[model samples]
Target: MDNQRSLWAAWAERLRQRFSFILQGQCALCDRPTSQVFCQDCTRRLQACRVQSSVLQIAGLPPLYSWGYYEGALKQSLARLKYGGRPQVAEPLGQWLAQVWLDSGLLERGLVVVPIPLHGDRQQQRGYNQAELIARSFCEVTGMPLRARGLIRTQPTTAQYGLLRLERYQNLSNVFQVGAALQKSPNLKDIVLVDDIFTTGATLKSATETLQQSGFRVVALFTAALSERQIA
Candidate 1:
């Protein structure tokens, strides 16, 4: 049964990729004609937003790493991926993040890629979890094993968009638990949690603690975008 499920999932992913390639249209950010999610100009702009990982020093996050700052093209791209019904956008962004991680000299053995999950209700509404989508692409490029369900969101908390720091922390508290995938694979330790955005660090903090309490070591928090301000 598990083998069949894996085969079907691989087939579905291949079909999705083929369709995305064939149906390429306007850039998600600028609506300019392109064969990819973002046009060449927008892609260049997004690349320009890259920063050294050393610059991001949040007080409570695990060895944070992000592809770009959450402003300008990078910000718009993430918004389009998360809210504009464009899951295809995650492909290139995740690949770019993988490239950055490779160049950063942080690659290590025995690390598993785990995407921060969405609660079932919200995930059902969104049709997909952006973090999982991004992590899929990340794992594809980096050749790392992806445990997409290593953590689960057990509770649906309020959206953290406009919430203050205290509110964001409160909103995410007790929302996550180590998932069944981790339980089944006792050898899968030293996690790298992937998410689409890093705003106040609240979400990752809660997730890291949950995994830690469950006997897993969360080595890093990786994201596609990082807010320039601690509170975004």
Candidate 2:
């Protein structure tokens, strides 16, 4: 029964993907008519923000790969994706991230993509988790397995926008719990966390520690954009 259910779920996902393109209307950034999430001109401008190099060795975090700096078109697109009811925006962004990862020669077997999850209440309010949406498209392009529910946000925290660096860390402490799927298979390792943005790194740090403590090896973090402060 479990195997049958898995097959059904996979079929349903494929069916959804098959028709997802038919729903596209206007570009998320500009209101241009487009079958894609972004228009050609907007996509070109967004690509201009891409970081030439793929990997950045931050002081204490895992190897990070961000598609672009969080500024200009990239920033605006992310804002629309996260706050403006534009879930379709993730499709292209995730594809872009996957392309960069492939081009960087970082492709490897057994690395599971785990999207940073939102708390249940927050996800219910938003109707979707942007990170998970991005990770789904990323896996579609990369063929890497996606553990969409590998981690659960057990506690709801306030928005981290105005908080200081230390405060942000405090906000997310002990917030992530290993989901049941990951708990059932203790051998699953080699996690690559995906998120829409890497800001002060507080959120990723807490999540990485949680996964590490749970015995999973977090190899890298893949994000669509890096905060301007991170670029400096």
Per-candidate TM vs. native? 0.86, 0.87
Estimate every model's Cα lDDT from 0 to 1. 0.88, 0.90
lDDT of 2 by residue, 89-145 (tens): 999999999997898787878788999999999898889999999999999999988
**Candidate 1 TM-score over all chains jointly:** 0.86
lDDT (0-100) at residue 118 of candidate 1? Answer: 95
**Top-scoring candidate (lDDT):** 2
